[model samples]
Target: MIKVAFFDAKSYDEVSFNKTNADYGFDIRYYQEHLNLKTVPLAKGADVVCIFVNAECNAAVIDELIKNGVKLIALRCAGFNNVDLKAAKGRIKVVRVPAYSPHAVAEYAVSLMLALNRKIFRAVNRTREGNFALKGLMGFDMYGKTAGIVGMGRIAKELIKILHGFGMKVLAYDLYPDMEFAKQYDVQMVSLDELYAESDIISLHCPLTPETTFLINAQSIAKMKPGVMIINTGRGKLINTEELIEGLRTKRVGSAGLDVYEEEKNYFYEDRSDKIIDDDVLARLLMMPNVVLTSHQAFFTVEAMHNIALTTLESIKEFGEGKPLTNEVVEQ
Candidate 1:
């Protein structure tokens, strides 16, 4: 039987993985700590290692894993930005669940937009204290608003459908244009600059790469309409937090709904409420009335969790059977 070690193992991860591992019967080991260079020794004797989004699978960690006889690196999450593919090129194969329940994230993105626009967070807090005044709770209708989507992937498509249902215009920008989907959904495939200038709200669903790193900066934010709402359900590093804070200070960005942050590695997915927040930008953002932030939980739905576990194990099983790894990530 192939042995596998899972890092960054949470209670939910254990529940889902243990339920699914019964089918494959792999010798699965769970570690609550994140996988890093120092923790590579924990993976000794295991043929494969499974990791989450926050694990630091750098060159040194990959080298040690190879030295420990590890063959494959299976990522439970979709994003592999933290992994160094070049270091594992010839030594260890890497696979990930690329698309698992896109609706889970897509729906959550819409929820963020709605919650921010209608000031739902503020309303709930006031009501809890018996303050039922609607003075600061005024909101605009979404029917005539235009939403600019940064990517046309599966999650963006799902978001487009939801936005269309609310009678919102959809403008999308993608490296590879899908005219068929645009025509079907009544979405306009526009240039990035045009989308930035014309959109009343902008949402990022793109992956993190050299071209997309810090895609939302001062320059891009300058081109956007005044008081435009920005939403990011994609990778954290896509936005420059300092620039965002500046925009918030100047009221250039009316509001923001973020499920991820650029410096989220230290605080996200962990219970640090009892401790002082060291990240000043994140602390300031939390104090803002217009900004709504969630702990990278857009993909935490039951359906998505189950699919992530099933697809992850199925890929490992395929690798063991000498079949093609459909989700194997190759160097670009």
Candidate 2:
């Protein structure tokens, strides 16, 4: 029987993973702790090791996994920045779920945008306390506003649809432009500069790579229109937290909504309410009423979770059967 070890297995993860693996004929071992060099030994005889975004699969961790006879590393999420491809070069195969319910994440981004613009979180809190005055609750209509989307991928396309439904003009930028989709959605394919200067709201949907790291830095922020709202549902490093804090302090950025943070690995997926926050930038962000931060749960819908578990288990099964992986991430 194939042995598969899963790291960072939360309650929700176990529920979906088990449901999908029930008939896969694999013996699964789960650990609540993240996978690292110290925990690599636990995968001793396992053929495959599954990990999530928080697990440390660095060079040292990868080396130890290879030493422990781990053949495959299955990532439940799309982003694989946490994994060191150089270390796993020819030793272990890496695979990820490329697309898992884009609508789930897109809708969440729109929800954040709407909540921030409408001051729903603050209004709900005030209403709960029997204070019904709309003293500071002022919001602009989304209709007729220009929305700039940084990526034209699946998630971005879904966001475009929702924004179009709100009667907002859509401006999109992507390395590879989809002319057909742009025409269909009445989205204008514009340059990054135009998108920044013209958009009333800018949302990031790109991945984190060498070219995309800190894509929304001080330089980019300066190009944006004053009082422009920003939303990021993509990777945390895509926006520089320091620059964002500076913008918020100066009021260069009107309001921001984020589901991810640049240095979220230390704070996300864990409870820190009992302890003082060590990250000063994050602490400052939380103090801003205009900023809304979530625990990187934009893709937390049931459909997305089910797809992730099914795809993850299928990747392991494919590797076990000596077949080429459908979602393989190989170095060129």
Candidate achieving the largest lDDT: 1
Per-prediction TM-score: 0.99, 0.98
Model 2 poorest 10 in a row by lDDT = 17-26
Per-residue lDDT of 207-266 in model 2, one digit per residue for the tens? 889999999999999999998899999999999999988888788899999999988888
lDDT of 1 by residue, 1-332 (tens): 99999999999999998998889899999998899988889999999999988899999999999999999999998899999999989788999999888999999999999999999989999999999999999989999899999999999999999999899999999999789989998999999999999999999999999999999999999999989999999998999989998998899999999999998988899999899998899999999999999999999998999999999999999999999998999787
Q: Please count the clashing residue pairs in each candidate, in the order shown.
A: 0, 0
Provide the lDDT at 181 for model 1: 87
What candidate 1 gets wrong by more than 4 Å, as runs, is none
Q: What ranges in model 2 sit over 4 Å off?
A: none
What is the overall TM-score of model 1 with all chains considered together? Answer: 0.99
Rate residue 8 of model 2 by lDDT. 84
**C-alpha lDDT of candidate 2 relative to the true structure:** 0.92
What is the TM-score of candidate 2?
0.98
